[model samples]
Target: MAEEKKEFWRWTESNWKSPDINWNDAKYMTVGIDVGSVSSQAVIMADGKVMAYGNMRTGSDSPNSARNALKFALEAIGDMPEDRMDYCIGTGYGRVNVPFADRSITEIACHARGANFIYGPQVRTVLDVGGQDIKAIQCDEKGKVTNFLMNDKCAAGTGRGMEVFSDLLGVPIQEVGDRSFEFKGEEPAAVSSTCVVYAKSEATGLLRKGWTKEEVLAAYCKAMAERIYSLVERVGVKAEFAVTGGMAKNRGVMDRVMPFVGLERMKTEWDTQIAGAAGAALFGFALCKKGKGRKK
Candidate 1:
């Protein structure tokens, strides 16, 4: 029998709602949808506090992904009516395509704001590595964007980039970070290319040359760190740094990247991947409070 093809990078999809919230008592109910190239997220906030959220793998249809994400979020909270939401804001690559969003915001701004909310007022810099791109953002005390830069030119070092490696190694994506560190030998040198296709080829060559899977993973993780560091350096990093987006879960890349940045990362209890949607929901809440969204 042919070897079973393994999907190593498949992360969990989940929906959650805060038990403390009472929908009937929520003064302001807002929603945020983030539809990206590789994932989609929905966040529901009640009176500026997170009430519920859902995350899913994005499909080819942006609108469908947005709706599905929202459905998942509302499903956990008794499936509220859309008209009940005071405002809806959309972010990420497909922000403009959200059919129900009252407004759209840039991912850069949303990420900055979300990072501030998650890490508190101390966060001055954010590093977000997503499916199709990586972003380095600077923000003020109030979560306003001061400076930001993105690397969307290619997929290397992003979520999709790492996914390629995981699949190639027949390792689940969630395990990549830990497995990379399991190698007892000296860490291998970083991969040479920042292009996903080229890096994949390079990885193949290394495997052919007797490099163990763990060694390859370590090398790939180091390369991803180096790529992210270069982007952060160009944006002028500062103290109180925080990382958001799916890649934030990867300790292998983060451990290497932290040394290059020369600063301790600010900690947050919130799910890093939900930062963009959370920020968008906060923006919607602000808009609703200002009487700029749905009329009463």
Candidate 2:
């Protein structure tokens, strides 16, 4: 589980229509799904707002996980008309296997789309912390991404990273964020080792040596945040760096992150975590519009 530098890749379709599309048809409702390694999200767009959003853990197989996520969101949407549900867009690691989608998009694009939509025009860099992947994206004025980097292979700075530590600390994952914000000084322990296996083992030694649980956890958080900061800095650290993805909810990560940056906003808007799904929903709506144009 060592920290590995990875790519923040972005792919946009200039003429992205899948040959399977029948653009002559028109539909009123749209849906999007973002399938990540550890979790999947689904969203529905109707009535000028997101009608439903559902999130679920991805099982051993990712395709099933994508279906399960979409099923959950469809259930949440209740009663949208079947004929009007024109498009289903999919993004994320498992986007290609999302059989129901009209088009598959890169997670980077979806994240940018989702962040720009939620945070408006100000966001230039997006920091996304997924369950199994973490990415830092740089985008221009129109929410179109310019460059990106991703750590799809590691658990060092992701939701899974926190989960592992929570288990070690006997802290619930939901509350880990709240508790980490209470620490008072530089952590006595340094979870600085690159490999998670080594770091976790080192963490135990720190605890056995009489280091308070708070300091050890704080140290771990700091180390993890520093890793994320490196990725953000790679994206150039523009004024409005917004954060999204599952790990965005962790206060521990945020606390350690805020004091180190000179950007206008240290943390990202809360909804950015759901940016991938939201972008999918918007992309679905775009498909519906495309269908109308072909008929005219």
Clashing residue pairs for model 1: 8-171, 8-172, 8-173, 9-173
TM-score per candidate: 0.97, 0.83
lDDT of 1 by residue, 44-153 (tens): 99988989999999999999999999999999888577678889999999999999998899999999988988889889999999999999999999889999999888
RMSD of 1: 1.1
Give a tens-digit lDDT track for model 2, residues 30-83.
Answer: 677888876788776662256666777767876787778766765554444444
Q: What C-alpha lDDT does candidate 1 achieve relative to the native structure?
A: 0.90
State residue 139's C-alpha deviation in candidate 1, in Å.
0.4
Q: What C-alpha lDDT values do all the predictions have?
A: 0.90, 0.71
Give the CA lDDT, 0 to 100, for residue 13 in model 2: 9
